[model samples]
Target: MLSGFFRLEYQNRTVLGEWKKVHWLKWKVSIGLSTIN
Candidate 1:
């Protein structure tokens, strides 16, 4: 039971990390576009 909980926690962390990276990329792209305009 403990192991299952830990696995779920780990998966959540991985998903959160991916989401952060995607958001960061989107932010950078917006900034770049604004600068170009």
Candidate 2:
């Protein structure tokens, strides 16, 4: 039971990490475009 809980937590963290990475990339791209224009 404890192992399953830990596995779930790990999965959540990875999903969150990927989400943050995608958002960060999009944010940077928008900033770059604004600066260019």
Candidate 3:
């Protein structure tokens, strides 16, 4: 049971990390585009 809980937590962390990376990239892209225009 403890192992399952740990796995779930790990998965959540990974997903959150991926989301943050994607959001960061999106922000950078938008800023770059704005600057170019």
The lDDT for every candidate, in the order shown, is: 1.00, 1.00, 1.00
**Where is model 2 more than 4 Å wrong at Cα?**
none
Write down the lDDT that model 2 would get. Answer: 1.00
Q: Record all residue pairs in model 1 with backbone atoms less than 3 Å apart, i.e. clashing.
A: none
Error of 3 at 35 (Å): 0.5
lDDT of 3: 1.00
Candidate 2 local lDDT, 1-37, one digit each (tens):
9999999999999999999999999999999999999
Summarize candidate 1's per-residue lDDT along 1-37 as a digit string, tens digits.
Answer: 9999999999999999999999999999999999999
TM per prediction: 0.97, 0.98, 0.95
Q: Which of the numbered candidates is closest to the native, going by highest TM-score? A: 2
Clashes of each: 0, 0, 0
Better of 1 and 2 by TM-score: 2
Which of candidates 1 and 3 is the stronger one according to TM-score?
Answer: 1
Q: Output the better candidate (2/3) by TM-score.
A: 2
RMSD of each: 0.3, 0.2, 0.4
**Alpha-carbon runs more than 4 Å astray in model 3:** none
